[model samples]
Every structure is written in C-alpha cells, then in structure tokens.
Target: MKKNLVRIALGLALVLLTLGHSIRLYQHPLLSHLDAITYDARLRLTQPGGQDSRVVVVDIDEKSLAEVGRWPWSRDKVSRLVRQLTDHYGVQLVGFDVVFAEPDESSGLRVLERMGATSLKGDAAFLASLASLRGSLDYDGQFAATLKGRPVVLGFYMSNGIPQGALPPAVLPAGTFKGRNILFTSWRGYGGNLPAFQAAAPAGGHFNPLVDFDGISRRVPMLVEHGGQYYESLSLAMVRLLLGNVPVRPGYAEGGSGSGYAGLEWLDLPTPRGALRIPVDENVATLVPYRGGQGSFVYLSAADVLQGRVAPASLQGKVVLVGTTAPGLMDLRATPVGEAYPGVEIHANLIAGMLDGSLKHKPPYALGFDVVQVLLVGLLLSLLLPSLSPSRATLLTGAVLAGVVGLNLALWQSGLALPVAGVLLLILALYAMNMSWGYFVESHSKRQLTQLFGQYVPPELVDEMARDPERYSMEGRNAELTVLFSDIRGFTSISEGLDPKDLAHLINEYLGAMTTVIRHHRGTLDKYIGDAIMAFWGAPVADPDHARHALLAALEMQVELRRLDAPFAARGWPALQIGIGINTGLMTVGDMGSPLRQAYTVMGDAVNLGSRLEGLTKQYGVGIIVGEATRAAVRDGVFRELDRVRVKGKDEPVAIYEPLGLAGSVPQAVLDELKLWQQALRCYRAQEWDQAELQLMNLVRLNGDCRLYQLYGERVAHLRQQAPGDGWDGVTTFETK
Candidate 1:
C-alpha cells in the first residue's frame, strides 16, 4: 500500500499539470499544436465530400487574364461583368472577395481634359468631341452605376496600417458593446472600397481572415472592431443580405454572467424561417467548416461570365463570389485542406456553413468542460492503474483511450470543437508512469540476476532468466551444447603493418561486430582471446536449436568480417578475413575460473575439437567448417564434406564439412559442384587414381581459382607416384595443432 502511494501521487501531479494546460491557467505549446492536428484530422474525416452548388466562386484565373488584358482592367469591363451576372444570369447574391480601393481612370478622359486645357485649348472640334464623350469616358461612375440597387456586397480589408478609401456603416453601432467583455479582433485601420462604390452598394464587409500562429488560415473574425465600430465579414454580410438584411444580435450563455464571464458565443440573425445562430469562439471568430478540397464549390471563370460563354442556368439563384485564382494576384492561402487553397473558397465555405448552421462551435464553456473531463479521466486512471496488473492495466488504458476518442468524435459530429489532446496525453502519461514504477522499483531480485548474466548472454536470454531467477546461476554444470570459435586469418601480419593505435581500433571494431552477430543468433559470448572470439549456445537459458544457432552465428561472422573491407581500405587498413568453426556435443558450462577472478565459460573435448576445426579452415579454403555432429543436428543446413581427419590430440577421425548455406538459399550451381567434388573424393579414397584425376581436371576447368580442388589434384598426382597398400586407411592425420 505504501509503495502504491508514491505512484498515485505522481499520477495525480500529471493530471493537475494537464488540467492547468486545458483551462489556460498555463499553456503548453506542444499540447496546443497536437490539439490543432487532431482537430484537423477529425474535420477531414467527417467532411461531406460532394460539391455544394449553393455557393460558387467566379474566379479571375490566368485564362481570364490571358483573354482580357492585365488586372485593374478598365472599370467598364468590370461593369459589363456585373451587368451580365445580375441581369442576364440572375445570380441571387454577388459578394466580392477583392477590394476596389482606387478609382479607375483608364478611359483617357484625364488626358483629353488636360489637352483641352493646354495644348488644344480653344479648338471647337476638340471641345465638342470632349463634351460629347464625357459620359462614356467616366469608367468609375459607370462601375458605381452598375452596382446601385443590386444585391452586391463590396469587400474590404482590416489592418493596423493607415486607413485608406471609404468604409461603409458599421454592423454594430458605437457603444453597443461598451460594458461587455467580448474579445473581438480589433484593428486600427482598414482598406475599404472607394466612396462611390461603397455608397452605391451601401453594404460592405472586411475580407481579412484570421491566421493562426502556425500560419494556417482556419477561421475568420465574424465581427471585427475598427476604431470602436464592429463590422461583419464578407461571408456574414452576404448571408445577412440573402436573408432579407436580418439584424445582427449578440448571443451569450445564460449562466456566464454569474461567474463574471460574459463572452459572446454566437451571432443571431432573425430570419423568416427562424433565428439562424452562427457559432463563434472567444475571439468572435468562427471555424471555416471546409467541405472538401479546393473544388468544394463550382468555379466559373470571370472571363467566361464577361464573354457570355457560361450557361445561364449555372448562375441562376447561386450565391456568387468574385475573386482571383491567378498566381500573380497572390490570393492563395495556407489552409488545413491545402497549402495553396484559393482565398475566395474560404469565404464560400463560411457562407455555406452559416446557411446550414454547420459551423463548429468552441464556446467559452468548452474550457470548463475540458477541466471536468481531465479531472474525471485523470483521476480514474491514476487511482486504478497502480492496483492493476500490467496486462489489465494495458487493457484498461486502451479502453479509456478508445472512449475518449469516440466521445470527442461524437461531439465533433454534433458541431462542438472541444480539445482532446490534453486528456489523451494524460491517460498515456499515467499508464507509462505506473508501468515504469512497477518494473524498476518492485523487481529487485530480477534486476540483480540481469546485471550478473547480462555480460555473457544475450539480452533476450537474460530476460528469460529474469522471469525465473532461481533457475539460473554461474555454478558449473554439464550440458549438451554447441560451441563456436572464430579467428582472424593472418591477424599477426595485419597487426604488424599498422600503428599500435590503429591496431587497437581495428581489433575493437572486429570484436564488436563479431560479438553482435553472436548475440543476434542467441549465442553466449564466452570470451575474446587476442584476435579470436569464442561463443556457445544452450546454456544460461537452454535453446532447443542450439546447433542451428551456433552454425548461423559462425556463418554470419565471416560475412560480417567481409563487410568491413571497404571501410578498412578507406582508412588505409588491410581487408580482413575470418575463419569460423562450430561443433555440437556434451560439454561443461557455467562459471569456471580461479578465485582471484571468476569467469563464466565452457570446457570439454567438444570445446577443444571446435578450436581444431577453426584451424583447418585455411587449409580447406573455406570460410566456415563444422564437425559431423553440428551438420547432423541441423537438418535444414547444406554442407559439403571437406574431409575425415584425426587431429594432433585425438585418434578417432571425424568427418568435417564446410557449410554452404541454408538448404533453399544455396545456389544450385554450387550444389552441383559439391556433388562432383564428393564423387571425386570417393574415387580418391577407393584408390581409383585415373577417375579422381579426370574429375579434378573438370572441376579446375569450371573454377580454376578453387584452392581445395588444386590441393586434392596435387595429392592425386603424388599418390599415383608412391602408392600405399590396401591395408592403409583414408584418414589424413594433422600432426600440428
């Protein structure tokens, strides 16, 4: 009980920390970013992907610029487009995503007037012509005349720079929000339309989107303040105009005032159908409920509209937006849906969401809800996890995580935008804390056993020993095991060519690589003697496939040594080669050393025979040599019998084989060659010198670089000259160790 108390206290502290981040008592940047990411993921998953025809973007694309002249085209051209949209196509509402801040003077009226005042003064023909062309030459007046008495909403922009052009009347009057503590996006200046355009429309809205800290434009301020006056966004203005110019009113939560929180939650617009509520966040901004990618709404080229090339029914009753998609105009935005999304589409999505009441709401009470959620989930996990076993704790944690994600998604589908990152992170933190505490603090005896055996055995075996520590020790015992020995060929000469420092580094690298291969194959590394390595399997933790593991490790050691060739040459060191031998038999294993310094090792005749096989690899011209027992134990292994030999210390001859590879992995060509070699060896043992010589000649023709074939070829020739009697056996005896 006392042990669990510390973990419980630590878990609770994590809960409190996450709670602080949730309620904004303090902010965690990583948690906030994660919340944004999760919100984007949920939004994308639930978005209805089909196109929405209710809102359309009249794009000023590159095609339009190429067909017409460059941008800031004569106002007469723009006026014609407006007349075609409203009179010919009968669009329901037209909102501009672009602002006309300067007057159009491309009609040459100013130049003609100046010439009349100076260069061509008092010329009667010129004066009459000028007087007659006055009405036709006034382009700005033409554009304003086209805008009058139409359901067109001009767009403006807000900023902190100096005010430019003219602003329309505010949506909320001065002093309307005097005592309220609503947090609106405030600006000091704006770039509005010209006076004539604003007066002709009598309704204009700002097109400035609210860009978050990560540079993604995810929301727009529905009501922004400029010089103590509140103005609606272009999307809001168009929606109001479509609903018969409904009055905008602030909607607040009922019980917020009691807690001194009077933040506005939504904007209410009373229509004939009902009161349409547009949800807003603490900054009076609403999330843009993106329907899909860039083509969520239909896009018709502005040039098509001007030239009467568009179908009339496509624009009928459609709420149209006029904006540019031309790259030179730079109206692209980084959005959650795409990095290069059209800015005009943002307004269209908002207008569509407002009409359908699908705008996601992140109300002020969401913070309180987050606080409560963290408290419930964090406390439940904190108290329950410490008392549960590991498997049960994992299952419980998984269930809680699923529940949290599921509930959050459900709320998201219902138009709520509550954060889920804090609670999810809290659950994971608590689970990890409890699990780590249990492993490190409670299992002291297992840790001691791990420390003792970790140096000699692989970590996997040590983990198994930890499960039942009483069964494993350094005490010596006899066990049927497989032992391996590997030595670097010509290591003495290789060391003589390099400096002492270089040699030391080389040996460390070689030893490290070979040891890693041994551990990877589940072999216990017994020791390293100079440039040699010794390892064994089926001790400490017994493996049923000990012979297979030892053979695999020996084969891999040679391959690993070859991999060092290029790097060694690059460092001015010689290419390295190693010979490995593996044997399987009964042997003594465990801690075996003097009292002065103890070591865990293995010994017996099998160990000594394994060493002898490693010494014969150079003579056989093979990388790995294995005794008969190892080759027999591994039924899946492919080996070519090298010889039957009696070493210096043993009188009984043993068959030795060179491991080709695993059965399926060995090349068919190599297997065929091995068969021919076996035939030749059988003939040589039978004293059929002529047949053996013929087979050796064919093998040398196939591969002239084979040292084994050459060595046997010399033996056949020598034995033909000095033939032994039939009483002699076929065993080759090695007199040197």
Candidate 2:
C-alpha cells in the first residue's frame, strides 16, 4: 500500500512539472511547432473549400498588362474594370489585389497647373475636369454603391518595421472605430492607403506572410503591431464585414490594460451562403496549405478572362483571384503547397474554407488529453513492478510499448492532437524507476543468487533470476534439454607422471576456464568426472534455446582450449584436445541428492547417450559429435551430419553430427570432406560394397586412422571373403562405454 502511494505521488509530481513547463514557456516562439502540428491536423479534419463557388477573382495577367501598358494603371482604367466586373459580368463583389494609397498621379492636376488655373475662375474649371476624371477612374462611387449591401473584401499590407495610420473618421466602423487618436512617424513610409479607393471598398483583409527569420512562413498572427495599440489584420476586418458587424469596440475609457476586447470570440465572414465563423491566427495570415511544389495547385491565368478566352462557365461562380504575376514584384511566398506561391491566393482559399464550415480547432481540451496520457502510463507502470513476476513483467513491458503505439494511432485517426514525445518519455521514465526500485528492495536475495550461480550462468540471466525469486526454485523436474559431455583424450597419461598436488591444481585451472565458457553460453554445470565435465540446459531456469546453447558451448570450449594451449606449451605441458558429445531429449534436471549434499544434475536415457557418445568421439576422431536431435534443435546451423551409429546399450541407430565451427565460417575443404564421408556412409548402409570401399579409401587417404573407417574396412574385407546374405540390416553392433 505504501509502494502504491509513493508511485501515485511520483506520478502527480511529474504531471505538475509538465504543466509548469508548458505555462512558463508558452510565449516562446519555438513552441510554435506544436501549433504547426495542430494546424496540419485541422486541415485533415476540415472539408475541402470551393463548395458554393461564390467568391471569384478577376486576375491581372501579362496580356492585360500588355494591353493596358504596365502595372499601376490609371484609376480611370481600374474604375472601368470594376464597373465591367459588376455591371457586365454580374460579379457580386470586387476585391482589389492592388492598393491605392497616394492620390491619382495622372488626375490631370499637372495639366490644370500648366494651363495657369490659379484664380477662382480657372480653379472652378480645373475642379470640373478633376470630377470628370474621378468619374472615369475605377468605379469610385458607382462600385461603392454596389458593395453597400453585398459582401466585398479588399486587400492591404501592414508595415514591416513601422505602422499604418488609423482609418479616416469617415471610413471607420461606427461604434468600434471611436476616438480620433492619430500618431504619425514621417521616417517610416506606409504604402497602399489610397483614401478614395479604400473608402470605396466595404471591407479589406491584410495580404501578408508571417515569414520566420529562416524565411520559412509557418505561422500568422491575428493582431498586428500598429501604432501604439494592436489593430486587427485585413482578414479579420473583412470577416467582420462579411458578418454584417465590425471589430468589437475597445472600452479603454480608464486607459489601463485592454480588457474590453476579452469576450471577442470569432469573426464571422459574409458569403452568398450566409455568415460563417472564420477562425484565424493572431495575425490574419492563413496556415498555408503547402503542396510541396512550384506549380502544384491549378493556376488559371487572368488574361484569359479579360480577352474572353476562358469559357464563361469556368468563371460563372468559381472563386477567382486577382493578383500580380510579375516575378520582380516578389508577392510570391513559401507555403505548405510550394516555395513560390502568390500571397493573394492563400487568403482566397482561407475565406472559401471558412465559408464552407471546414475550419479546424483544437479547443482547450488538449490539456485534458495530456492528463489522460499521464494517468494511463503512470497507472500501468506503477502496477507492473509490484504485481507481476519477472518473466510476466517482461511480457507486460512489451505490451506497454505496443499499447503506446496503438493509442497514438487511435488518437490520430480521431483527429486529436495528442502529445507523443512527452507521454512516451513519461512512460519510459516511470518504467525504469519502478524496475530500479524493485531491484533495490530485493538486492540481498539477488546478491546471494548471483554468488551461487554467477559462475554457472550468464550475468544477464542471473539478473533475471534476481528480479523475481518466487518464479524459480532449485527443485528437480523432468524437462527436454540438451546435455553435453566433454573428456580430454589421453589425460590420464599426463596426470599419471605429474605430482598429485600439481595435477589437482592443473585440473582445477582447466575446469575453471571450461566452466566460464559453459556459463557464457547459458549452460548449467552438472558435475565433473576425473578429467571430464558434464553440463546440461533447462535447469534452475529453463531455456527454450537449450540445444543451440549446448552446441555453442561446445564450440566456445574448443576455442578456449586452443587459447589455453599456448600458455600450457610455455609451461612445458602438452596441448589439450578434447571430444564433446551432445544429445537432446527429456531429462530430470535440477538440484538433486539429499538436502545436505545437493548438486544440479540431469538423469535419463538421453544423459546416458551423451556420455556414451563422448567415448565414441575417440573412435570418430572428431572434436565434437552431436546427436541428430541436438542438431535439429540448433537454430544457428553450426553442425554437419557425420554418420548413423549405434552406441553401446542403445539399440536404435542414431544420426550423429559433427560440430563444424560456425555455419558460415567453416572451411570449404572441411565441408567437402564431410560430404564425401556422408556419401560413403550412405553406400556402406546400402550394402554397396564396391562404392563403399572406394569412398572409404578416399576418406582414409584424406584423414586416416578414424576408428569407424578402420572398422568398416576390416568388415568389408571379411564380407568379400564370406559373401554376407541380404538378411543383414547393415547394423554394426558396438561394444563401447
């Protein structure tokens, strides 16, 4: 109970730490990636735009520039363009991509000056001409009247390092645009504020890309830094006009912090369908739907519309964009779609998206999502260590990893923005902590277990046993495992000449080295018989890979013995050569004998077969011989079939395999010789005397004095003399061990 309480306290502490970090670093721009990820999710959740085909663009293309002679065309021409779009094409609203801040330069004012219109009489004539010129310019009052009741959105830019002036009193939103407070800095120039032109359009949006320092356009701010106070961007203002309302009036009558605008929720956009809530970034720039290409999305040329080149049906109700295509103008931006995208087109997509009820929002429930993740991981982690056994705990650990991945997939499918890295890190941290604490509490028993079995098993397996003592016992049991027996050839002679004390010391040294190899391969030492050692798998702890472990142990022991030879030679001792025999079958394996005299061991027919094969290893003249059962159990393919033999006390003919180094690293000659010998064995078993004699002769020449070959040759010679009958089963009875 106390452990559970401690775990809960730790989980709560981690959650609080995460919460504090988020709030403290909320204002930093680096955290914007989270918002970026959120925006991407929004796009996937929302529907595609261009559903109603309400908004359209009257583009200004190269052909139009050719006909009208360069950009910034005379206002008289713009006024006509506006009039045609409204009156002829029946276009409902006209939004200008072009801004007119300065007064009309070509208003013929210079002509009046050149004509010397200084007095009142001349001034009156000049004024009449100016009025006519205004009338001829882009539908000034004529277009304004059309936009009165209908929805219209205009375009403008914010100062990069300065601020745009407040709207004139005549053009301000009635109640919202109060108090005639104006501040001007002459050093910073504000462009695109043509008083007469702006007055004509009902509403406007800012055409700006919130480009980062690295020139990557990621986020857009809803409020722009203008003058001493923040002003809503062009998109926000346009949305307000679409809703038949305006930005909320800030009631800073006392002149403290601006709390009056706190209740402002979302700007509503006006379209042919109806007013729609258009959620936006702090600044009006839309999250670019970058398609990763230069010319990814469809870009229709505006020149086709003016020349009657494009089909009428194409522009009948489709949203068209009117923006500059000139390369030098640099109105292009890097968007999610492409590196060079027209800035004016992004707003068109955004407005269309907003009108179709396709905008996405995360709301404030994202915090709740984080809380859920912490609770899930923490609870699972806290329960795992205290409740599960070691092996079961390991299985649960794997399940936890899989569970995390599954949760992430589910949340993504549901269109939720779940924090990934933070939650996963929390799970990992908690898991490690619990496991460490569990180890700490059981350290004493673990230390004792390690001391007892450290020389008999790998350290990793020792740690596993130490983690959960209840799962394992030294009691005996019958299980299928591979047993290996190795005996040094001619060891009796060497020991016979040595002093007894020196011989005992040397044997201990050799056994110590061999025991290390066995433990490294996860084999439990069974016992020692004079100059021989016995080991078996599936003891104290069961290894599913028992056969593989036995084979590896044999190979490693050979290598270690070779390494020991150099040092032994320096000490005037003969190099050691040993033969190992391995057999796989069911055996009673565990701690046996009386309580006061217990030792880990295995006993069964399989164990006896292993000992008998070790004796036959001298007759085969091989370093290691493995029964067919053992070879089949090995996953590493390290053994090659040698022959079938009937050992003493065993009636069944057993296939034997020679442990030939590693599978891939064996020498080609060794493999070839083994194949030749295998063919000879097949011939001998088939009673094909001539073929068997020829193959056995080749084998004897390549590696002479093998007891099986000598024995076979003597039998074949006798068979040639006696002419044995077909009743012979090709069985060679062995009187061995």
Candidate 3:
C-alpha cells in the first residue's frame, strides 16, 4: 500500500507538471522541443513525394558561373537574362531570392567621368564623349529599366536587431485594423533592394522563415510587423502579384466575448482565378508542406537563357524563381528531407502550396487539444493499471500507445497538424512508473526472502515466497510435515577419477536439478551434507497434502536423473543413479542453529527416519523408500510393501514401502508381483517354510533381478532348516545408519 501511494504521488506530480507547463504557469527546458523532433519525423514519413510543376527555379549553379563569368556578373548581363525570359521565352513572372543592396559599378562610368574632369577639361570632344555614354554606363539604371513593367517581385529579409535597408510599404498599412487588438511577429531590420529597383516593381515582400528551436525550418510566417503595420511574406506577395496584383487583407477569427483580443487566422488574397486563403497559427506561422526534397521544382541554369540555348516550351507561362545554388553563396537551409536545401525552393514550395491549397493547418487551440489529450491518457492509465496484473498492464499500455500513434497519423493524413510527442511521452512515463512500483518498491521483501532461502533452495522457491512473504518465516515451529532425503550412489568412486572442478560442477548441477524438482512441488529445503540433500514441506508455507507433494517430487528426481544419462555420457562421464527417502510426521522446523550461524531447517525423529530410509534404498535395490507413515498420508499413491524393518536408534520395526506411481497408473504386472510377495511374507510369518519357499521361487522366476525377492527366497530356505517359533513375526533388522 505504501508503494502504491508513492506511485500515485509520482503520477500526480507528473500530471501537475505537464499541466503547469502546457498552461504556461511554469517553464522547463527538458520538456521543450520534443514535439519539434517528433513532428520532423511525422513530416518526413508523410511527405507527398512528387514534383510540383507550378514553380521552377532558375539556379545560378556552377554551370552558369563557368559560362557567365563569376558571381555578381555585371547588371547588364543579368539584364539580358531577364529580357530573354520576358521577350523570348514568354515566362509568366519572376522573383529574386536575392537582395541587390549594393550598386554595381563594373561599368567604370565614374572612373571615365573623373578622368575627363581632371585631365581633359580643355578637350570638349573627350568630355562630350563621356557625356554621350551616360545612359549606357549606368548598369543599375539598365537593370531597373528591364524590371519596370515586368510581372516581378524582389525579395528582402527582416531581422530583430535594426533596420538594415529600406523596407517596402505594408500590405495592410498601419491603422487598417479595427475593434480587436491583433499581434504579429515583429522585426526591426531588413535587407532590401535599391530604391530604383523597388520603385520599378509594384511591390516586394519579406522571405524570413521561422526556424524552429533546433534550427530547422518548418514554418514560414505569413505576416510580420514593423512600425505597427503588417506586411505579407514572399510567398503570399508572389501569389498576389501573379493574380494581377490583387488586394491582400488580414483575416481575424472571433475571439472570446469582450476579451478585446482577436486571433488572426488567415491572409486573404483576392484574385480573378479565385480568392486564396493562407492559414496561419497564433504566431501567424504555417507548417511548410514540403512536396519532396530539393528536386521537387524544376531547375534551369541562368546561362542557358542568356546564351539562347534553351527551349521556350519549358519556360513559357512557368513561374520562375531566380536563386543561386552555389554553396559559397550561403542560401542553403536544413529541412526534414534534406540537410542542405536551397532557400529559394522553400519559398517555391510554400507558394505552390498556397496556389493548390495543400498546406497543413495547425491552429492556436491545438495546444489545448494536446493538454487535454495528455490528461485523459494519464487519468485512464492511472485508474486502470493498479487493478491489473503485470502482463495485463503491459498489454494495455501497448494498446494505448498504438492507439495514440494511429489517431495522430489519421489526423496528419487529413492535413491537420497536432502535437504527438507529448501524448506519447506521457503514456511511456506512466507505464514505467507503474511497472517500477511493483518491481522496486516491493523489493525489500524479496531481499528478505533471498537472504533466508538463497543457499538452501532454488531461486524459483524464493520467487514463490516473494509473492506473499507475510505467510512464510524462518522462525522455529512444530508442524505435521514431510521431509525428503536424497543422495547419489557410488559418488566416492565417481569423484576419484575426475578433477576437483569437474567433480564440483557435476555435483552442483545434480543438486541443482533435484532442488528444482523439490521446489516445483512447493517444498522448503533444509540443508545439504556433502553428497546428500534434505528438504521438507508443510513448514515455511504449509500444504495439507505435503506427503503427496514429497512423493511426487522424489519420483520426479529419479526421472530427472534418468534423463541426464545421455548428457553425462557425452561429456565422457559415468552415468549417475540416486536414492530418495520420504516420511511424514510431526517435526520441528525453522531457523535453528549455533550462535555462529542459524539456518532454516527441519529436525526431530521424522527427519532422521527419512535419512535412514534413504540409506536403506540401496540395500533393498530400489530408487526410493518411504516410511509407512508417508505411504498412509499419501493414500492416492501405489506402493509395494518391502518389509517391516527395525533400523538403528529405533526399537519397533517400521514398515517400508516403494512407491510405484499414482493410484491406478501402476502396471497390472507389477501389482501381480506385489500380491505374490505379500503371500510369501504371510507364509514365512506363519512358519509354513515349504509353502514360503515355493512362493519365493515363483516370485524370483517372474522377476529374477529383484533383490528383495532373492533375499526373501534365501531367508525361506534358512528358516526351513531351522524352524522358528510361532511368535516370530516376518521383520528385518538393521544395525547401521
């Protein structure tokens, strides 16, 4: 009960911790980012693998660098590439995954004008020549003129530090929203194109992806805030530009009544094709629905278009993104499917998804859904597990885990992004708690059991007692019990030829096997003396049918010895044979010994008689011998009455019996021999020596190898020569132990 209480306390603590963390009452780093890793795996598993033909990439790859000089190839060269896309290739629109912040001065127009003013001021022709090439020398002007009326949008970045370059006007300018307050991810700085290029295009947008805590890009925010105004992302801005420069608006969800706070749900872009809805989370972020890895979009080299070597069919009416694929340019990103992904392709995926509406949805209330999910699982497992067995608890926990994953997967398949790692971690934690409560918390009693019975018995016996230790003890007590004694035959001779290690191993293995048989019948071990073993039942934990259990255990031991014959022979060792003796009577059993050491053992005449019977087994040429008391106690057993013998330390002769098998399971032929043997004993006691001798002869003829029959036959012959008195009873006497 104390263990269970501790488990309940731990469970409650875990639930409270999770609750507090989910509700933001407390913060912990250990439990954070687990959801991000699990979500990465889910995204990888469910990635819709195929090429998205809507957006194509014009990569400034190595081929382009080799063909068209190095990076920052003069603006006039870029001008030709743009001209071919618009005039020759018939492309729909283009976007730059770059920021042209610095002016291109590769034309040397400033140098020429400076030389004319300093050295050729008197030469009007030289000054006039430099003035005549003013329009041609201005490369920035050349590139800006090419982008004036084309369907093009330039890209920029926003940072939290400070404004780096000029930022374009917001899609929904400041003071455009009313009534409820809304918040957006705010940025303080940006890297924008030159003023001339910005003025030429209709608009520009930020392309800042919200990298997760682990530095992997999963969600790209649809809107960012600057000076209390909201601006659209590059993907959103690109779609708006593609739809003939439609108007973009902020969408708000109805918040709780009178809270004066609203949830920004989506960015609505009005277009002639149709009105497009871009869903956003509370942070205004959307999970990136990656179609595949890097090759999902078509990649064309910029040099191919400038050199006029590409077909127009590939570029006609295709949305093109101009970005560099060179590693040195540092436009690479880490994604679920790849370690080095191009940043431009990320925008392409997002824009393509916005066009086709394959983007996944993760709303703000999904956090509440995760909290409730964890709590419900915790409650159900805590209530259901304490009443179940260990195996049943394990089975139930596995089913719950499977169900959690299955339900989450089904939701993911339908494009709903929910938290999975938290629920899974909760189930695993609760299961571990439940299992550990039983194992570790209850281990004190198990330690006690092992200390009391480790050497005397097998591990299985201690394990059985560990199930309920209160019922068993080492304290001495008197009880009606059955004691067993067993020893190997000719062990001294067997050990003389073997090494000490081999001999010890052989003995330990034999003893171990016999002990297992004894414990299997619920018997408690007393002690071992050299090659002998002593065990008893109905003591430590009592059994009413101790005699039957002892008898069965003895029979099982003999059968086990037989089964070891081939294995022992294969080891080049001699075959082993053993004798067992069992007796049932009142005896003192418990932890009894000298001051130096005490052991859990059995004592009294019954135990001594059990030992004496084991010694007599060899004399009678049998595997086992049981006292008449034990035979009577186990009434369901079939036995052959050997003789009424007076052993050492006993005045009255006790009847000894050999157990054949369970009742009705013994062979009829053995029963016939037993009947004839009984008749022989009766006639010998009646002093009818001739008739006794005749019965013994018939018994020996039926089973010649039986030593009991031969001994009786010889006794009848001796009694015939010297006739005994009528008072003489048929009994055997032994003077040795």
Query: Using TM-score as the measure, which candidate wins?
Result: 1
Best by lDDT: 1
My TM-score estimates for the predictions, one after another, are: 0.62, 0.43, 0.59
* Runs with alpha carbons beyond 4 Å of true place in candidate 1: 255-261, 438-737
Evaluate all candidate structures by whole-model CA lDDT and list the values in order: 0.91, 0.63, 0.84
Model 3: per-residue Cα lDDT at residue 623: 95
- The candidate, 1 or 2, that scores higher on lDDT is 1
* Candidate 2 Cα errors over 4 Å, as ranges: 1-20, 25-54, 61-69, 104-112, 115-152, 160-192, 209-233, 236-265, 268-275, 280-299, 318-320, 365-421, 424-737
- Cα lDDT tens digits for candidate 3, 488-533: 9999999997899889888888888888888888887787889898
Q: Which stretches of candidate 3 lie over 4 Å from their true place?
A: 1-3, 161-164, 178-181, 255-260, 441-737
Question: lDDT per residue, candidate 2, 1-737, as tens digits?
Answer: 56467765675565555444344434234334544444444443442433334555455656667776677766556555554455555554545565665455565555554564445445776667665665444333444454454444556666644535323222223333234331211123234555544565566555655776445564444444344434444545544555554443322224332444332223444455654554443233334433333332344455555545655565554444467756655677765444676666655555555554554333234556766766666566655555566667667766886787577656654534345555555556666665666555666777778777766667778877877866776667788989999999999898887788877877887899999999888888878888899998876777898888888889899889999886777776777889999999989876678868877678999999999888878876788998888888875675656567788888898878787776788888888987887888788768788998999899889878676678778777788788768887665567868
Using alpha carbons, what is the TM-score of model 2?
A: 0.43
- The positional error of residue 471 in candidate 2, measured at the CA in angstroms, is 40
From the highest TM-score down, the ranking of the candidates is 1, 3, 2
